[model samples]
Target: MSEDAGRVPAEPPDLRVGHEERAAAMRALDTHFEAGRLDVTEYGERSGVAGTATHRHELEELFTDLPAPHPEFSPAAGPPAVPEKAPDRHPLGHRHTAMALLPLLAVIGIVLLVVVGGQPAGLAFFPIVFLLAGRFGPRRF
Candidate 1:
């Protein structure tokens, strides 16, 4: 048999979101909006997350149940859409030398926890030391 025979296949274009999943997400969105927990402007902005026609329709249905769409509404400023890149796009934001101490810190925490768990004051000091070490230590990065 060829190596490619082991590959799992893809679906045809027609299948999108399953109906039940769409309805549930819609219900949660509607409940938040209807409870006065969400204002109309906020609702308009967030409703874009539904990501499909069916999901939007479900929300519109819920809106129909509300008493009135309030007038004099300000259009909500949309939050910026954050663009994503592949993991390798950004170098891990760090100083090269700083990472050297991470293992040491872990060892310190584990040893302190094990050796000092029997003492109340030492146990308390353990976390304080760990936090201070994290702040001022780590090779100045």
Candidate 2:
């Protein structure tokens, strides 16, 4: 027996394409035509070939001179890499720091209330909390 008898045949690189693949190639050809890369006559010719293409290489040949938006035949490298977020400078952010100071601000306000001899001037300090909250609050889109 020959050594080749034990080995299985490898799949062909130019695999047969399906309707979806042909349609996608046609779409890519449409994009090139719209971009002015292919004139009306060339566009019609390439599109016709794309429609009738039975193998992946035949579709690939249609885009040989074109840029991206080509039909993918090879397997993807891997899942996309997620970007790493930067570390926070302060773990307890500005909002938390502002909240932490609320009790101290209230004490200062009360002292002002007592020393100001019943004048409502101490009420001014309470608005600082609101200003801090507005400045440090979670941002809306």
Candidate 3:
């Protein structure tokens, strides 16, 4: 194994930046300008420098006198966390239960519609139940 295998990689001060970083720095400068921390002329100067900055350190230097709301830089450290696996489920799960219940619910709804014999709006209940079941059913993947 390499000697540095166990160490978190250091973020070099002179790391080259891209357009995204420069834009972020400009946004920070705009915020300071709006908060009255920097006058129009100072804002213009700092924004110019930010627009032309080539390295992470150059951007960091722009915020030396400012407070929070700095541009976020990704750390050169450890690997990203692995996602947890989905839980195991039974062969007959929530989706199966829902599928079995839907027809039964429709039958009950039809019976109510026939017995009550008012508005046929009661038939809408079946579709609503079907939608709810599908939405809240267990994951297939």
Descending-TM-score candidate ranking:
3, 2, 1
lDDT tens digits, residues 1-141, model 2?
Answer: 999999977546577877888888887888888999999999999988988888777888898888887876544235568989978866978666776676667667767786876866776666675675566555564
lDDT of 1 by residue, 71-112 (tens): 111223356688986575327545534654664676576667
| 1 against 3, candidate with superior TM-score | 3
Cα lDDT of model 3 by residue, 1-141, tens digit: 998999976788998887888988988888988999999988988888889988899999989999998998766546669999877666657667776676567667776786787757776676776665676554477
Error of 3 at 82 (Å): 24
Residue ranges of candidate 3 with Cα displaced over 4 Å = 1-7, 76-141
Which lDDT value does model 1 have at 96? 38
- Quantify how close model 2 is to the true structure by its C-alpha RMSD in Å: 9.1
- Minimum summed lDDT over a 10-residue window in model 3 is located at 130-139
Give the Å error, residue 100, model 1: 85
Model 2, total clashes: 0
TM-scores for every candidate against the unseen true structure: 0.24, 0.43, 0.48
Candidate ordering by lDDT (highest first): 3, 2, 1
